[model samples]
Target: MKELRYLNKYFKKYWFKLLIGIIITIIARVFSLVLPPYVNKSIRAVEGYVASGSGDLSAVKGELLEYILIILGAALLSGFFTFLMRQTIINVSRYIEYDLKNEIYDHYQRLNLGFYKQNRTGDLMNRISEDVNQVRLYCGPAIMYSIQTLTLFFCLVPIMFIKAPTLALYTLLPLPILSVLIYRISRVIHKRSTIVQQFLSTLSTFTQESFSGISVIKAYGLEPKTNANLQTLAIEGKDKSMDLARVNAWFSPLMILLIGISNIFVIYIGGKQYIDGQIESMGIIAEFIIYVNMLTWPVAVVGWLTSIVQRAEASQKRINEFLHVQPEIKNEIDKDTPIAGRIEFKNVTFTYPDTNITALRNISFTVKEGETVAFIGRIGSGKSTILDLVARLYDINSGELLIDGMPIKKLNLKNLRGAIGAVPQDAFLFSDTISNNIRFGKENASMEEIVTMAKKAVVHENITGFTKGYDTVLGERGITLSGGQKQRVSIARALLKDPQIYLFDDCLSAVDTETEEEILNNLKQASKNKTTLIVSHRVSSAKNADKIIVLEDGQILQEGTHDQLVGREGYYKELYQHQLSEN
Candidate 1:
């Protein structure tokens, strides 16, 4: 219930419609009560007519026809108002559902990268889709039925007591027991519902991962193992669903049993009172029977409404768990601050939040506003991590990371990241057209500009060779393209951005040596006055940089020009000799 309080603002937003719906529900219940009173009157009329020697029955026949018409009109009005009630309240629920999803999505966008690392994509999707759907049931059907149930009780039960208090008392004796049953059953439902939702998230994550890695599964010949795993998850999910269903099964039968007990009280007591001449006629008993039946459906639905509410609360609690989390990175400044790209890491130390792995330790370096610096190192030498810091995908632990002489954290996060064009070692592209993928860097980029950037990245020829040319649609993650072509497309995307700084993290690793040489020449012409950072294991990529920094195990091993490093006897020199001999 506390978690569900989050939706109070929405209730306020649509209060007028809810008020109308409540009025309509009450009117509908009132209309339905008309039939029982008419039944009582008709039966009394018949008793009187029969007592009048059963002659000259024309007056009685006309009166009976008139009563039937009134009953029919009341039934029609009740049905119409019931439809209106559903339309208003149910539509409000849909509106609330739409707003809730948008709020969750916007909050998701605000969350930092670390959050995504800790959560699975499928689980996130489930919260937004499946969990929200369950909550909608509570908002719409649960609320509507609850109102209808209450309206019937308030409008009909009082009349029963006014007419026959003793009979009413006996009839309602089973209700308190029914209430206790509902309370106990609802507790079980809440517990089982939480477990079921967790199972859904687990199953969703497994299936998503399987689909995304289908290629890897096939290549490794693990289809049988994957199938077996999925089957196991499905069985477990089914068992959990059955557990919830078993609890729900108690509700309807319990409602029916209690309603039956109430009817027995009505018949036995009404019959006894009539025999004692304490009741005037069978008409009173007939009226009481009609009232009891009118209440039957609404009471039966109480169990269902409780189930819906319990399940909704369970799902909403899960949603609130993520919604309440404040993002680790906050935008302190409200205005955008322009970037100049003079990046300096003053004794920087950084550790990844999720794994607590220290990627950089007391690292210090400076890249001038328009200098191309190359970092060459073995694996785990903190080469790519340098680019990540420059983009502020993560904030450093204990260091002064300055951009253009100001603390990077003080700068507007969006503006700082916007000024840099980064190409990661893993080139990711969406499932879209080739032109659209390139245009992602610059949303309004023209076809001519796209062609120019593609040519500069040495990928335009490959694109034009396709039958669809620039319009060719890529598969997921640009799977339609070769590894080298994917890297080139990613490079083309960055080139299209034309930002103040470029961070290329081994993007040319997949390209052939000849193509890599040509692409490097094109990049030299393209990155003339832009600060660029190139991270690669190849000496060739580092040879043309203004300064090459060699790293080993998170620390600088050598820092100098190509000639200076090749002339000296060090790691760079030995690597250079080995590459030269191989070439």
Candidate 2:
């Protein structure tokens, strides 16, 4: 019910369409109800005339033909209204589905990276697809039919009571039993449907993860293991789906049984009343039977409609939970002056959400405009976190981070991020043409500009070797490209930005030393008069930096020029000596 309240906005937004649909549905039901009463009158006329021994056969024939025309007209009108009802209401549902999906996707885009890390991609996809369809079922057909059922009951009930009160009362004797069955079956259906949806999400997540890491599984020859795990998930999903189906299966039979019981009562009571002369012509009995039959479809469909409502409630709650999440990072309006490529961290500290341990602790450093600073650290030394903070992927928990002498939190997020170009360690690339991937850094970048940046990153030759050159579409995550090619493409993408500052998180890790040196030299030449930060584990990569900062255990252990650090007896010196010994 609470989740339904959240949907009021959509209903209100399209109230006119819903109202038109409802009106048409009511009109359709009214047309259906008119036939039974007219049918009673025509039968009574024929019966009375026959009982009187009148030879007015022509009159009876004329009346019968007129009755046929009326019934035909009613049926045609009913069908048209039904079509209109479906067109209006179902179209509203489609529109609402479009709106809801777009809203969710937009919110997903605004949410911080932490939210993505905490949730599975498959679970989110399921909510957007399967859960939305469930909700649409409730919004359209379920609601439409429910209203139709109630309308048929109200309009037809009094007509039945007028035709034969006692028989009508007897016909309703099965209602309480029917109510109990509906309640029980609906509860089970709702519960089982929820379990089925959850298991489906689990199956989706497992399949997605397996496909994404297929290469790793194949490399380790763990195909059998992966298949077994997938089989287990499939079985779990199938079992839950079967449980839901079983609950729903009982509904149709239960509805038929209830309707059958009511019909038995009508036959017995109406026949006895007429035999005892307590009732009038047989037409009344015929009318009563027609009214009871009218109740059949609605009563039979109650279980299905209830199942739809229950499933919708379940899905709405899940969707509501996702929509209500508050983003961890909030962007502010622009007020700070233009960026000067100078970055400073003053006593900054950060701990991830839901964790007690700090990832960065009281770390402070400054890089002046046009300076190239490199952070060299072992794994888990927080080198990447520093770069992440500079990009505002995650906000610092304490102290201040500034660019161009203004606190970063005060700077406009879009402008701040636009000023810094980053090539992450993963070197992620979307499924697009190689040229398009490079142009992502600058949306309006020309082909010539893209080629220039590609040459600077030393990936131009690779592009020329491909059959489609810049037009070749990449596979997921650029799996079609080698590791070195991916890294260079990422670097080229970043280089195309030509930002005030550049952040490279081991972007050249996959390339050979000579190639790395060549690319770095080109980067140095291209990035003149701009700030640069490189997070690297390789001493060879950091050896030519204007300044080197060595981090250990989330704290700065050393800061000096490359030559100065090599002369010191600390972690930096030890790392340099170890690399020298290895060489």
Candidate 3:
């Protein structure tokens, strides 16, 4: 019932079509029921003709022909209505599936970054693809067949009782018992099917992770380990599938037993009625046999429909859960005003969800308009966390982040993000032409502007040297480019944005010292008036900053000009000496 309510929105949209389909299905079943009676009537007509020795052959032939025509007409009507019902249901199912998939995708886009951080990519994929498909399958055939089964059962059961009440009662004796057994089996199947789906989701997650990290695995020489892990997941998935199949295996035989038992009872009762002269004609007995056979489908369909309902219910729960997850960060405050580039972190503290220790404790900082600030820190020192907070990727646990004296939470997210440009470590690129990748930051950037930004990043000459130049197609994640080249492209993209605040989070680390120096020189010129923040482990990278802050253990240990920090002879001086020694 919960699953039904979850899917009610889709049902409402397609209810009219479903109603039409149901009508057609009922019509088809009615016509199908009419055929058996016509068959029996035709047989009786033939027998009557044989009983009269001095036969009026033409009258008997006419009667027989009339019954044959009725049977043929009923069959034609059944086929036509059945076809219409199937087409309508199929069309509705496809439309609903398409809408559901797109809604899920749109919801995913609206979710905050923290959601992606916690959820597996493959699991989400399975929900949108496999789980949605399961729902679609249920919506179409399972729904249509269920309606057909009910229609047939209700329409035929009364006719059977009217034709031979004793026999009908005897045949129906096993029905309640069959219902109980099917209900129990359905519960078991539902439980097992849910487990099977979960295992498949886990398998999907593992496979996706392995593929995405294939390069890392090879670099670390862990291919054998990855393969073994994948094999283990595959075996688990197989075992779950086999377990579900085992349940299904028992299900069919039980259905056959129920059907067989019903048929045996009918045969016994009908035979006794014929012997006692309570019923007439072998033809009528044959017609009852046909009606009993027709009932078999409705009985068997109960099990099948139950199975589909269970699977769809399981899928619905997963999809609903995904849809219900509130993003960690959301724009709850109203925003009707514009903002300037000035930013401040006032007594802000943050602890990642599901953790006891705080990542950022009592942190406060400010960046004035058109100022350059550098953050020097070792790994895991909360430098990235500060940058993420400024971007509103994660919200602060306490205090406020303000842009241009206004709380950032009150500003429109799109407007806030539009004013910031970020270049992180391990730059990402799509499998597209170099030109398009650079144009990503500013969608409407002219070709000339793109080339100009590339030149500023010191990558124009390298790109133009290639045979295809700016039109050269890069591989996934720009695997075709060298590390330095990838970083330069990333920088060019950021530069194209022409944002007020530029964030360079170890963006220059991949390049050699000489290339880094050239790019930084160009960046210094390009960012002459814009506020910029550089996060670097190398002291040389922060040497030219107007203000440098040294971070350790999520705290600012020191802040001063480059010369002042080195003169202090603290952690900054030791880092500087180490880099100088390495050089």
Candidate 4:
């Protein structure tokens, strides 16, 4: 019920159009109501002629022609108003849908990485596409028909009572039973529809994950197994859909049966009164039958219309839940303070959401302005997590993180992120031209700058080898290129930004030893005056750094230059000896 209130905001925005549409709908129904009364009038005249034993048909013909023309004109007006009503209301529904979609998309952009980790991509996609469409259905045809049905009911009921009150009572007696049946069925329908939607989301999520990992599936020769898994999800979704459909099957026909019973009562009671000579004319019976027939369709659709309304309410609730979630990180209104490329971590600790393990603990360190530092540790040693914190991807659980002596939390998000150039562990690329992917780092970067950065990152020669060169369009996730090529392009993009600070999270892992040495040599010259932090597994990468911090189990186990740590009796010495022996 509360979720239905979300539509009130959209309704207010297009109230004028909605008001006009309702008025036109009422006018159309009223015109339709007029034709039934004319039918009653014509029949009564014919009855009178038969009773008086007059065979003259001239008067009847004249009256019939006059009323026929009137009814025809009324029919024309009714159709024109109906067209106007649909045009206004349906167009308003589309506009409201557009606004709602944009609102949801914008909210998604503001959410942090932690939120994304907890929710699946396909579920979010379904919420925006399918769920939004459900609400739009309620806004358009459902509202139009509901207004039309109610207007006709109010107009027809009074006339029916005036013609024959006792007959009217008999005709309406079955309606209360129909009402109760619809009310009970609607609750079940709502529950079943929600389950169907949730299963649809699960299916979407499974399909997306499967396709994204199709290469791995094929590599392992898992086609049959993968297909079986997909089929399992598909069947689950189908079962939910069948459950909802089964409920709807019982709803429509039952409503029609009730309406049929109401019609039978009208005919029996009116005929009995006529036979007893208590009714004035048989024409009233004809009019009553016409009115009851008119009421039949609207009455029958009560369950169907209620199904639409219930589905919309369920969808609105889902959208509302997503929109109302407050992001863990909020952008602050920070004072203008110049970033000096200095980072300080003071006894910081962080634990990921919904997890008991601490990812980083008591990790006190400082990277002074214009210094190059490297972190060498095993997998899951908080190396990437530390870089993630620098970007403020997730806030620290305790202690202070500072950028140029100012608390990182108090800094403007845009300003802070703008000062750093980051190359994540996964070298993600958009499905776009090679040049466009490089230009993403610097929105207004020139072609010459792109080439220069690419050359420095050792990827220019590879780009030139492609048929379209920099104009080549990439496939999804840059699948067109090899892993090492993707890494070089990612490095080139970060270099083009020319930021005050640089963070590379194991970016050179895909490159061979010779190429990695060449790229690192170039980086040494390019990043002389900037603060650079590199997370690497190779001790050779950190041997030249001003400082090397060895992390183990979320704690800083050792901190010194590479030579100072090589002979020490600690985890760093053991790792160095292993790598040295492996080579």
lDDT of each: 0.91, 0.88, 0.86, 0.88
Model 3 misplaced regions, further than 4 Å: 1-4, 54-66, 110-114, 334-337, 431-436, 444-451, 460-480, 525-529, 563-568, 573-583
TM-score of each: 0.93, 0.92, 0.90, 0.90
The weakest ten consecutive residues by lDDT in model 2 span: 329-338
Q: Write the per-residue lDDT of candidate 1 for residues 56-109, one digit (tens) a residue.
A: 689888888999999999999999999999999999899999999999998998
Clashing pairs in 4: none
Per-residue alpha-carbon lDDT of model 3 for 1-583, expressed as tens digits? Answer: 4864777888899999999998898999989998788888887877787888788999988888888888889999999999999999978989989999999998898787768877899899999998998888788988899888889889888888998888888877778987888778888888988898787788889888887777898999999998898888888888988887887777667778878887888777788888898988667777888887898888787788888888888887888899988766676666555656787888888887744457777878888888888999888788887888888888888988888998878888877788889998889999999999999989999999999999989899999999999999998889889988999999999999999888999998888898888888989998888888899988878899888988888888899899999899799999999999999
Best by TM-score: 1
Better of 1 and 3 by lDDT: 1
lDDT per residue for candidate 2 within 82-199, as digits (tens), equals 9999999999988888888888888888889889988999999999999889988888888789889999988887777776778988988898889998888888887887788777
lDDT of 1 at 178: 89
Model 3, residue 441: C-alpha shift (Å): 2.4
TM-score: model 4 vs. ground truth: 0.90
Q: Which regions of candidate 4 fall more than 4 Å away from where they truly are? A: 44-62, 274-282, 334-338, 444-452, 521-528, 543-546, 560-583
- Residue 338 of model 1 has an lDDT of 93
In model 1, which residue pairs have backbone atoms overlapping below 3 Å?
none
For candidate 4, write residues 230-270 as lDDT tens digits.
89888888888898898889876886787788778878999
What TM-score number comes out for model 1? Answer: 0.93
